[model samples]
Target: MSADLVLDGLDKRFPGSPTPALRGFSLTVAAGTCTAVLGPSGSGKSTLLRVIAGLEEPDAGEVRIDGTDVAGVAAEHRGVGMVFQRSLLFPHLTILDNVAFSDRVSGMNRRAARSRAGEYLEMVQLQGFGDRRVGELSGGQEQRVAIARALAAEPAVLLLDEPFSALDPALRSDMHDLLDSVRQAVSPTIVLVTHDRDEAARASDRIALLEHGVLLHEGTVLDAYRRPQNVRASQIMGGRNAVPGVVRDGSHHSALGAVPVPLDTPTGSGTLVIRQEDVAVLDGGVGPADTGSIAGVVESVRVTGARSEIAVRCGDALLHAEAPPTQRCQLGDRIRLMLPTTAVHIVAD
Candidate 1:
């Protein structure tokens, strides 16, 4: 069965450390859903996971699982299974034995434990390799064994602390697919700690962005990427354009000219934020002036993967835009940019 995990007002500080690892950190992970905790190093992502796993106690606040406070619970009794960044598999045990360790420790007979362990190995697509030693497996396969071991316990809540960070891009993508399959089959409530934005978005339903132990924003993946709450949040989410502007009378006025904003937008100074992908670049033309398109000169162009990243200078503001690699352009080329009013998000400066 899945469990709802909650961290309420958690504050933790290590001895002799100048700053708290987590300060007033709070978030709720719904049953059968995954929430990725995303932040840079020293952002307390790992510390939060440890607190939930009962491996570390918070100096203040509560760690609740399924509505019950588990202040004094031991790590093993918390009904949580954690997969660390490294596989940490025992060298002496076969993959099957390693996965069966949890069940055996719980007093299950050897035969029944191995039987259940086999099921989890199949779930990870390693059914035929259970007899192999840890040294015989690749890094990705070792991580798979680690996941199988964690799941073999039938944990109500699963914690993954950047388990795929060290894998190559292709292998990391494969692990994500495996995770999706695991969620479908068992539906364990999951809390994923990761610094990679793409991984957080691809692996979880929601994102909890942390900064210096502070919960900056907690929302759906799309909202975290497109509707960040502040300048720092925007930057963290990879927002490229943050044009200084003023919101007044349901419109934002800036170097890109006035664009319509939501009616409830406060009338004050703000920053107009738009993702590079949202900005549509067009050829220079003397067409209709009522199209709300602005003219600019291409300052730079760099092709990255399948997209071309472009920088355009319009009046006093330098805007970043993205286009297909086929849309070739050189520096000093005149271009028209269409900044969709719906795509323009006004955030606090």
Candidate 2:
């Protein structure tokens, strides 16, 4: 029921766009693995999904499902299930019928299709609302029905195009949990297209990062978080602190001071990437200074929700650190900043 999906040298150029939407983009997703294609608005995230779903033919390159080239194949015959950002359920159909539409179209008997639809409705936790009209259910409920409809067909590949982008924050979180549960029950190879990092990270096993129509990086969630391949990929995953530096011996010498980093890094000028969460802040009253300690003055403090973020000034550069909202540091206060060696990444430019 699940199949491996492969895209090889995919290139799609529209009539008047300045650049191709996808240029030599290639990725191999293992059977039943859920992967998210993450990028900005014009990065072709949805186009990549459309190509895989057979909605658009690639100008050059191929899409293969389970080792069979599906190029030029019809969307219906490709055995791919898709759920768009909008639910798009049939207006005239009842909630039960909307969930069962795929099965009926696939030629299952009326009774059998409704039976299976009821099972899927239960899977999406809408067991009792099957007979309600589509207009009667809420937006979240309709989206759930859309997902249930997609799963009822048992397609080899499932493509979700920002399925939760239209929902409120709380509803989006709930939909994410529901999607995970559905994937567990139906185990289809899934490609989730989303620009939201938290949504992508929550819904996917692996992440394929795209930018400007190119494949930037592809790896497990942990691998991406710990070691992104380049400066662009690192920034996409929230690696915001990039201080100019030079590679010296086997370390990087920056305004923040010299620190050991990857030596096989790019030559000449480069950047030292670090995340806010990785930067450590220590109160001067806590401990005596060591060799690696750096002194800085808190430039600003912002407390939002349960977390507080502060900017620290060291030399001519500024670094950010996050802490509990109860943290007592104020503007102009002196503090110590330490970046764990493991958290530092060198990217030559």
Candidate 3:
């Protein structure tokens, strides 16, 4: 049966450090869903994972798995499977023995453990490779074996800690696909910790951004991208082109120009976040008036496969725009650009 997981007011503080690794962080995962924890390094992503897996005890908080408090349970008794970045398989043991280690610890006979391990190996699509040494497999293959070993235990929840970091880019994408397939087949509640934005966008049904041990925002991918909670969240979510602006008269007036933005809050001064794709190119040497388009010259153009990204200089601000690959424009070409009214988000102070 699938079970939901909850973290209620979790906090952790290392000795001799003024700041806590985690501070009243709380999250809930619906059964059979994947929740990705994303943050910069030292943001306590790994600490939170360890706390959930019973490796670290929070100074003052509780962890509940499937509606039961697992605070007092030992790591092995918690029935939480963890796959780490490094495949810590025994070098001398065959892949089969590595997968069966947990079964043996659970009092299964050697023959039974071997049989169970065989089934798990097949599940990870490495059936015949069970007899091979762990050192003999490629990076991706070894990772698959690690996943098989973790799944062989049949834990209630699975925790992944940047498990595909060692693989190459192409192989990493393939592993992501394999992870989706496995999740759908098993329907297990998964909590993945990662620093890769693309990986979080690709694998997670819901994404949570953590900063300095605090959860800044958590929601659907589009929700986070569309409506970031603060300037930090907006920048971390990859809206790099931010402009200082003032919201008045149902529009935001910034260095670029005026754009329609919701003025719900009391606006003295705020930041306007614009996605690169939302900016369109205009051909002209003349600039638009106030409440008009911003004028800039193409500083550089980058051809990235299907689309071409253009960098424009509006006074001192660098505005990024994406255009069709077929549209060819040379450097030093002056152009007027507009930010989509729907895409411009006013970041509250």
The lDDT leader among the candidates is 1
Q: How many residue pairs clash in each candidate?
A: 0, 0, 0
Ranking by lDDT: 1, 2, 3
Cα misplacement distance, residue 147 of candidate 3 (Å): 0.9
Compared with the true structure, model 2 gives a TM-score of 0.94
Off by over 4 Å in 3: 262-269, 283-292, 300-306, 315-317
**What tens digits encode model 3's per-residue C-alpha lDDT throughout 20-69?**
99999999988888889988999999999999999999998889999999
Model 1 residue runs over 4 Å out of place are 285-290
Candidate 1 vs. truth: CA RMSD? 1.4
Candidate 3 at residue 277, lDDT?
A: 79
* Model 1 C-alpha lDDT per residue in residues 1-349, reported as the tens digit of each score: 6999988999999999999999999899999999999999989999999999999999999999999999999999889999999999999998999999999998999999999999999999999998999999999999999999999988889999999999999999999999999999999999999999999999999999999989999999999888888877778888889988899878889987887876667889999888999998875442456477888889999999999999999999999999998888789987888888778788866
How close is each model in CA RMSD to the real structure?
1.4, 2.0, 2.6
Q: On a 0 to 100 scale, what is the lDDT of residue 127 in model 1? A: 95
TM-score of each: 0.96, 0.94, 0.90
Better of 1 and 3 by TM-score: 1
